[model samples]
Target: MGTATPHGARAHARAQHGTRTPTMPVVPATDWPAPPAGAGPLVWAETVAGGGYAHKVLARGTELRLTDLHGDACAHLVLLAAGRPWERFNAADTVKVQWNAYLRAGHLLLSAQGRVLATLVADTTDGRHDTLCGTSTLVLNTERYGDGATHCATPAGRELLTLAALKNGLDTRDLPPSVSFFQGVHVDANDGTLHFTGSAGPGGSVTLRAEQDLVVLLANVPHPLDPRPSYTSTALEVLAWRAEPTRPGDPLWDATPEGRRAFLNTAELLTCRGQS
Candidate 1:
């Protein structure tokens, strides 16, 4: 199926409310089990250099971690089912159907096929992120930041994802839409323009738990609306480990009425493939 809306638009019409701090009661986060303490051994890890990109395949029970090593990092992440790239993430459906504009912990990033790709199972930053105002584009960056500014557009992320999927014999055209982590953006209530309100501090982090085998692509770049004088983008640390299976009363599956239904859809999809 085609995208319900261009991810480039980042759902321009959607209004959002987010938190500057996790302490804000208005942006409550779900309870996640305490991660095993210490910087233990990881299955795989890398530091994505500023302006660089990377991609990987995360199994259904793998955890992907993004860390803001320099206190100011933006990671544009795109995801698609490893076995079905056409069934990619749908930002509009994720926002409208799930009744949420801002995503934090306990939220499922839904796909156009009504399947859950991953769950925002953990966030230790400001508890805010954007599925709207996708990564900067070549045309956009050149227009605003001048020539060569096109260096870090979101497609850079697609390129990485394509590279990662190459082992699977997939190409760039198979890449899909993405969500920006650490980009705490919000829509102006009165004017409806997107605002880059800033993001995570040093050591801050967010985690995505794969709901199915996923082709993950990412880049460390400036948010489209970032006001920093320079690109200011820096290296980001990507870490992975096995994720525990969800059980009865799991918060993400039970976060909302839509979440439950989405989880069911994910289960049915997996079951049909005999993965369940």
Candidate 2:
């Protein structure tokens, strides 16, 4: 007698048999590139499809890397303090405190409380990340594309992030302004006009080390200002591994007095909370 197969299982078996190509399984890659010296084993690794969302809670000493696989993905990110959800990323502080509008290696991402959230430890995108412009919204994306809802093929960045927030036990109210990597914006110094510079080319990557425990939300979508008429974006590679957090004597910690103060603030909070 033949063994009985459940209805769902029988359907799945038939579909698999008829399929020419199968999607990759969601499993950790056994062969990722080496991490920095003294770094721990990889903790997270995944590929985010275009117009997709991803979120993760990283420890204080971990490093997260985002790569533009095909030179068209805009990795929009929003960071919140894992221990204290109210303390989220402050873009104004990140730029004003550093006295620089552009982000690069050694730059610190600051929070509203004047504490450091993450540090830009490595960047290959030539400091072409945007600090002025945020992610795309459902309304704008809907106007550009036929549909911008989360259930559609071309979900807006805001909608994707909203989903990420909800998955992490938060709500829409927790959403904050985000920063975009790989694609950049240029401000006309003469007239204060913002210009979209497009992508930084393929294989560009940026790595950020967590200064505090963080809940990071990422959306890989087309930049709102992208000149391309169509809603198109390529795949994005997300990799994270354990790494040593910045210390007082680290070059990045002392890169600038303002940055140093921010790191000190972060350390004090972590130490007081016994998270250090």
lDDT of 1 by residue, 220-243 (tens): 777778886566777687777776
Candidate 1: clashing residue pairs, number: 0
lDDT of 2 at 123: 97
Lowest lDDT 10-residue stretch of candidate 2: 18-27
Per-model TM values vs. the true structure: 0.78, 0.90
- Give the per-residue lDDT digits (tens) of candidate 2, residues 52-110: 88889999898998989889989999999995789998889999999998998999888
Tell me which residue pairs clash in candidate 2.
none
- Candidate lDDT (C-alpha), each: 0.71, 0.86
Off by over 4 Å in 2: 1-6, 10-39
Error in Å for residue 251 of model 2: 0.5
